[model samples]
Target: MANIKSAKKRIKVTLVRTERNKAIRSKVKTAIKKVESAVAASDKQLAQANLKNAVVEITKAASKGVYHKNNASRKVARLSKAVDSINA
Candidate 1:
């Protein structure tokens, strides 16, 4: 239990932020998984579509500071490679 009012408020704010972050991360993970599954199944069209969605989600995450820009770019590159392999 927080004894001070400020401490209590901080705890509440932290909880809210945690919940939001979790939701964003979950969405990102699901999007990534959808793309990965399509890649694994060798479905080029579906993988490309899912890859776009994944890139959008990842970029949003990066903009939100959940991930570094370099990390986001790396992930996007990997996904692009997967899509290319499908095309090849």
Candidate 2:
């Protein structure tokens, strides 16, 4: 319902950005889940591997503005802690 041309363009851009953000968010969630599942299975090596991947994905998301820097840091910290606990 955007009558102005600029408004129409903005709406289109918004939709595209929304989809992109959703995909990034989904990827982040999947990565986090993988780490959690590996930890739950009590496989330290698998958990460590998944933790590395999850950290990468989270950092990328934060850099891309999908997540706040502190939020991403917190997530990585918690995941790392879980993996470390397995080793202890």
Best candidate, TM-score-wise?
2
TM-score of each: 0.92, 0.97
lDDT of 2: 0.95
Which residue pairs show collisions in model 2? none
Question: lDDT per residue, candidate 2, 1-88, as tens digits?
Answer: 9899999999999999999999999999999999999999899999999999999999999999999999999999999999999958
Candidate 2, residue 29: CA error in Å? 0.4
- In model 1, how large is the Cα lDDT of residue 6? 100
